[model samples]
Target: MDISMGDEPRRLTSCWLYWIAVPTGDQAGVMATLGLTQPTPVTFAEAETIIDEDGHGEAEGNPDGLSRVYVSPEVDGWTLVIGWWCDPCDGERDDEVLRRVTELSARYGRAQAYYYGAQGDGSAWLIAERGAVLRRYCATGEAEDDLFTLGEPLPLERARRNELGLSSSWGKAVGNDEGGSEWKSAAFHLAPKIAAALGISPLALTAETRVRGTGVLALTPQGAEAEPVT
Candidate 1:
């Protein structure tokens, strides 16, 4: 599935999800734990612009207003947090919320969901339910085809850049065969389950699989370097 040259880095379009449990702490502390020095919170106006362009947070979004979806560039990568800010609401509103949740889920369907919630004692919730971001993006020539011969602009979907938070933009490009990740992220996602099923390391299912807080491993049934898609 890797599409770019092994030596030259290719840029790609990536959207990620960060599952932040409600009322974790102020944004200041959250950024710190992620190793991000500080993050400038987007204003409602700025946030709206990004959502409007992406078809998220539309009037059709949800009744709660408790959910907000926005794109953010960071050192790690391009991200979108389909996050909730209210209590679970006695399950009375859970279904609607869950449905809304499903919408964002579909938008970034293949991303690794990193769950983060506050600890009861209140002193920085590093571990999510557990615990956990990139930058301005660089544009790679490779763009996916969508809708009536139209294509997504590569610049917006580029590599992690200084504006987004990464130290370098060169490695951020997608399409590089060696480091270019397949758009179908499910293989990386299902690695753990597949490994357990095959009784092998997670790497067997995929290469250099890094699922947020989850550590590294080999998952292929054949004891290969990384996991192979089933």
Candidate 2:
């Protein structure tokens, strides 16, 4: 049975994707260093096995430290690596883990990583690439926002000025539809647009980037257009 489909085994509180510039053959070495048990190439069967074995493990105490690692079929000379952590919470541990993964992966080549997850009362999404944090969105008390530069400053400025507006209202809107799946879908869908605005190839988005907001400017074939969630 497809575990990703069917009755959800548990509340999926966190998901992450890493675009590593390293070859797919290097995935095992990278993951092993991160303390992930069974750090095998991702496949339907492998995923099922991990889920069956580690599904009940808590994020804060999972012995494996990672649920799974997926190395996407090579595209445009880059290999996309994805990771999933369950029931994640905000803290130094999470930050350190993300930092280590990105930093280590960058040693091999350019790496872009992002994560999306909800805590007890709020949700957030973050993006990083080339060893610098590109964007961060959190729907906590005051809705913190952060963006950094990686050579392209104008686009970052534009995105910041535009401000995706992923405030509490936007979260409520997406949460009401499809049990929060819409938010994840929208966040992934906006990756390409965000990359374009950053003047980078969509693939440079590390196969996926998490974004949140009420409105976003998407680049259509016709041209750039304003897309508002509300």
Candidate 3:
């Protein structure tokens, strides 16, 4: 079935079968923009996945705990990265989510795995080329029988995301009608390990760290630099 954003036209839900994309810049900001809460790392493994880019802090690795399988696919000159929180089919919903990512992962050439993060749910987000989205799904939003929700502008700008090698917008549905899965709540739910490793919760740890976790994609050549993916 097709989900409509009023008169904006219909979008396929097939994108759901794929994965969600979170920007590396503003994780919490994007969650709030979408009415979702920030997510904290759940298991010890999760804590390890979170990396600090600024190098202001560091975290110890978690040898125990559940970590989902990971896969990085390349499609249509883009990298499609996917990870599962757990396996669902084996009743390990989290691993299953990761399995889906591996299954959905594309081979080299077009779309490749760029970046991936573990999701609270049994799923993770994959970052791929904009072109991959077009080819992966029919231009008409038909071929894969998929639909997407073109929601409001994320906290981050498209120009910024370009610098991050991600798209400007993450325009699929990741929330309930009431925006149930707020990243803020997610952040609180997580162990300090995950949050610390990913450099998340900077808003709390630092005395005056800005909460600028906007998950926008960088589209310009400049965006593709070590700059924001606006």
Candidate 4:
């Protein structure tokens, strides 16, 4: 009798994630501007509990200190997940989703931002600011070579790749190290650039940044008030 391992667990596929640099005290305004509803406040410990209990994939938190965690019911096949400390999950890359994320980032004075998503036969990631797509990647095939970049490379884009232990062939083709280093480095280096472009200090992008916000606010259309997600 062959006892086989059960079906492989689904990898936590990232949809789209963003890093917004909200001001220390203006989270409410930013949320409202994004049409998000008032959020439920959860302490770092409580946030961890929620992630362990309800999160679908690998959930990460801002190590510095998670002031609050926000969660909204699934909307249009996607959910709005926000953390005041900086780290948040990716979501669907719909136009509305992108528009909201871009709006929030800009409202918060061009906060550091990133978005990623995978649907059907394609996957893409974006580093954006003030409603502009700064750098992006779209996967064509399973191979790293299948991935394509959009927008011009940043001045330090190549150097960032090197720092992340990635090779120049990254995204062009699968290298000996595979796409692991390249993918990881993309965000690591890109974060600093996002902060810099927004005129925010690099240190602000780290977990040490002490930003705060109302957690898990709801987003509604203009001329309407956002309701808190229960």
Candidate 5:
């Protein structure tokens, strides 16, 4: 069953997953870029159902790590890749995730990844263009040293820093003990908003969204095997 949005609009939350957006309608390119194997055609509705079921560990034959994903067709000039494989909460896998996102941006001119965790425990976002990640931020509410962050903060993040009375330079503020804690706390909820401003928020997909083709379910390289959960 579809999760209820209540009076508020649908927002990407829980079932912790990563969303990758690229400005193109080429679903094949997206699938190939992610190295996804075993293409299986599915409509948007079916894709959503699969994702929901997998999130609940109730999907038929759902693997331990759900090495499967839903790739949406072009919607309003953007294509979205949804999966848990790219989640940024793992400090050990941070470089690997960034490498994948950079590869996508290198091929598509620009790519963005966003993560929203269950119960607001963590959140992250990365924006890359022309083979370079311009900004990356992650706050997993884990060890302080494990807070993976890189590049400069985006404009929206800068504005938020100002609102929080942080220094103009994000690096400098993060260098401060107090500022770092405050920013991390605030960043825990910034993924969804940053995603909306930079490209598309997962929940922003609506009946009004311009859709060019159907979504599809694809397998990761390991097929039904599990990827380590952070």
Candidate 6:
């Protein structure tokens, strides 16, 4: 059965979520590259349920609290790996997450990860190419500096800034008039658009989306080698 995209493109969920999109339909290769194992076939809806229900739950296999990702096959030449543990905004794990995403890009040529938290109204995105991260941005909708930023602003980001009458250059003062939670909130909404522009956005998946093969549930590396309890 095919799932409808509906009007869910802008909202990840009621809380938080993270997903990685790569430009390839090689499901097996993607799982292997991510060090994921124990694949279980599942429908797109079931996959979403698994991720949503177990995203923050502790499981026997995941003793380290790593993410158990749902690996979608090919959706318009891109595969999405959904799991909360893949979050890029985690301060402590941000570096490791970026490293893994960069490595994934190295193998696949291009990869992107997105994070959104409804509670804080935070959104983040990272785009990597050939093992190097080209751009990364985060906004928490708080009265603080940008959480994290790197490389140059993406064309969409530049255009957005221009539309909002903000500075095109990063770190450049855009005056208090143009600086407020509006821009940060805008970032939250922009994450999905960026995903749509670059590849497939999880929220954009629908019956109309080109899907090849089925999704699979896989254990993260932390749980891949765990021994079953006696």
lDDT, residue 163, candidate 5: 94
Go through the candidates in order and give the C-alpha RMSD of each one to the true structure.
21.6, 15.2, 21.7, 13.2, 5.1, 4.5
What TM value does model 6 have?
Answer: 0.82
Global CA lDDT of candidate 5, please?
Answer: 0.71
Question: Ranking under TM-score, best-scoring first?
Answer: 5, 6, 4, 2, 1, 3
lDDT of 6: 0.72
Q: Quote the positional error of residue 119 for candidate 3 in Å.
A: 20
List the global CA lDDT of all models: 0.25, 0.35, 0.24, 0.39, 0.71, 0.72
> Residue-wise lDDT of candidate 2 within 18-131, one digit each (tens)?
222333334444444444342223333343344334333432333343434444333333333434441112342446545654565455544444333222233333444555
Least well predicted 10-residue stretch by lDDT in candidate 3: 7-16
State the TM-score for model 3.
0.19
Candidate 2 total steric clashes: 2
**Residue 82, model 5, lDDT:** 78
* Between candidates 1 and 2, the TM-score winner: 2
| Model 1: per-residue Cα lDDT over 1-230, one tens digit each | 12122211112111311232222212233232222221334432344333333222233333222333322322122232323321112125333333333333333332222211211110000111111111111111224211111122223223322234433323323333343444212112332232123222211223232212111111111112223211
Give the TM-scores of the predictions, in the order they appear: 0.21, 0.40, 0.19, 0.46, 0.83, 0.82
Residue 160, candidate 3: Cα error in Å is 30
Off by over 4 Å in 2: 1-25, 32-37, 41-68, 71-76, 86-89, 117-136, 139-157, 160-230
Misplaced by over 4 Å in model 5 are 1-13, 144-147, 170-176, 179-181, 224-230
Better of 3 and 4 by lDDT: 4
What is the Cα-based lDDT of residue 1 in candidate 2? 23
State the lDDT of candidate 4 residue by residue for 1-230, as single tens digits: 01113211111212323334443245556556555453555433344344332223333322212322344222122223443223322223234444655676565434333322223233333445666756554332345422435465554556666676666444443232465645543543354354445344322223332333223433334213322223
